[model samples]
Target: MNQSMFIVWRESVEALLVIGILQAWISQQSQSHRLSKFLWSGVLLGLLLSGLLALLIMFAGDAMSGALNEWFQAGMALIASLLMVQMVGWMHRHGRSLKQDLQRHADQHLARRGGLGLMLLALLAVSREGSETVVFLYGAGARLRGPELGLFAVGGLLGLVLSALTIVLLHSSRRFISWRRFFALSEAVLLMLGAALLVSASERIGGQLLAMNLPEWVYGSVGDALWDSSHWLNDSHGIGGFLAGFAGYRATPSALTLAVWLGYWLLIAGWLRQRREEPLPCLG
Candidate 1:
């Protein structure tokens, strides 16, 4: 539930950020009211696009059965994990210039195509964020059902509310929490969620592999638990369960799971380091 909440919160915040940028630009235009209508229309269309995607995913999942279903879910989880990493990296590189870039594009669009171009711009931006949110939520909550699914839905709704409040707070006062700090903190959490999704994918794949006639060592590495920690912190309940869902915690992890978890963090660390060391572009 927390995973769903966070996913929705983060994605909603990003979508809102894009809309706010476009709206702010439009507010300063000569035909502000005219453009505002197009902008809002675009936003509505983008949301409809995202809703269609969600329905497609749900129907596709329901259509599949047995191993194929597992494979599909695993693939979705893997894709979501990769996208999360990519989003963080892209934001790390482009966040400082995002507002300027949006306004510049808005200017060009309005110049070339008037309100139509502005509408298209807003549509693409909102759809990108909304589509991502749908995929991420599906990956995170694919297995949820009954009460759990209800909670997940509630979490998403609460997240949406929180995001609105968050934007208001940020716009109202930077003294409390700046955008930079918010992004930095959220990036870390996103990476952790990515790890969780990656682990989930690996586990699903491992289950499929285990069912096959694999070599003995392969089974040992993928299926055999190295040690038991459930006595201390059972991953199936309470705080540990939340950690398992949010951060990929394991009470009795197999070698394959451990290897994947470690490799993910190592890659993330190296990527972040390289990004940090890259020289900033020189201004004229």
Candidate 2:
């Protein structure tokens, strides 16, 4: 429920940011009255498309029940992790140019394609975030059941409400809160959540591989019990469970899982390092 809430809040906040920027730009125009109609239409259409995607995910999950579902789930987890990584990176890359880019897009559509183009722009922006939210929620909550699922839905609703409030604050007065700091915190949390998904994916794969009766060496090397910290910190209950849910904190991790976990962080760090060293492209 916590992860679901966070995912919804983060994704909704991002969508709101884009919509807010476009709406604000439109408001500044001399003839924005008609454009407002297009903008609202686009947002509604985007939301409709997003609802379609959610239904698709639901139906697909319902269709697959056994091994196929496991594989599908594993794939979704990996995809979610990759998406989270890319999302944070994308925000960083476009953060500086986002406002300018949005305005330019609005100008292009308004001049060339009129209302339809602007509508399309808004549609794509909102739909992208909306679809991402669906996938993230699905990936995070695939294993949950019963009343927990109810709480998951509740969390999402709360997140939406919170994001609405947040957008208002950002648009009006953000003196008490810094957007940069907020995103920095988000990036950190996302990385941890992404790692958790990766770990879950690894477990799925390992379970399948074990079932296949593969070479003993592979299991010995990868599946060998690394340590037993369950006594000190049980991953199935209490604080350990929360960490496990948030950051893939396994109390008794196998060697392979540990390697995969460590490797994920190292690779992400290297990517960030390389990205920092690369020269920025000239937008002029």
Candidate 3:
């Protein structure tokens, strides 16, 4: 429930922020009412598309069972992890430019293609985030049952409502939230969550490989348990649990998982540091 909630919140907040920017820009221009209608239409269409995608995920999950199901799940988990990285990185790099980019897009599309272009742009933007949310939550929701699943849905709904309220408040005040800080905090959380998903996916894939009669040696190397640090850093309880849910914390990781985790951090962190240290262009 918590996992789904956070991802939903983060994704929804991002989408809302985009819409808010569009609305704000439209308000400042001529033909503002036309632009508003186009934007709202885009949001409505996006929500319907999201619902359809969610249904597709449900049907697909139900269609596969047993080994095929495991493989499918493993694949989804891997995809989810990769998507998380892409989302966080994209947001970090483009967040500051989001408003400007959206405004430019609105201007160009509004001038060239009119309302239809605006609708298409909004649909594409919202659907991208919406579809991602569907895939991610579907994969995560599969691990829960009964009341847990219900709670997860509740969490997602609350996240959407809260995000909408936030957008409304920010719009009314005409004050942009600090996109940099918002994205930074969310990116950190996502990085950790991606780690957890990666570990889970790796373990699942290792299992599938074994089931397919892969050499025991391959599985052994990939699945060999490393040190158990659950005693000191239990991912299932307290703060460790929070970290586990937000970022993947493994009490016992395979050799491959450990190496991959370390390598991923080193590469991403190094690049981030370099980017941060680079001198900014002096404005004349």
lDDT of 3 by residue, 217-245 (tens): 77876767778888898878898877766
- In model 2, residue pairs whose N, Cα or C atoms come closer than 3 Å (at least 3 residues apart or on different chains), thus clashing, are none
In order, the Cα lDDT scores of the candidates are 0.91, 0.86, 0.77
| Winner by TM-score | 1
Candidate 2 lDDT by residue in tens digits, 57-84: 8899889987888888888888999999
In candidate 1, position 36 carries an lDDT of 99
Structural similarity to truth (TM-score) of each candidate: 0.96, 0.93, 0.87
Count of clashes in candidate 2:
0
> For residue 174, what is the lDDT in candidate 2?
60
Global local distance difference test of model 2? 0.86
Number of colliding residue pairs in each model: 0, 0, 6
lDDT of 1 by residue, 1-284 (tens): 78888998999998998899899889898999999999999999999999999999999999999999999999999999999999997887778888988899999999999999999999999899999999999899988889999999999999999999998988888898888878888988999999999999999999989989989999999999999999999999898998899889999999999999999999998998888865332111
Clashing pairs in 3: 192-246, 192-247, 192-248, 193-246, 193-247, 196-248
Q: Give the lDDT ranking, best first.
A: 1, 2, 3
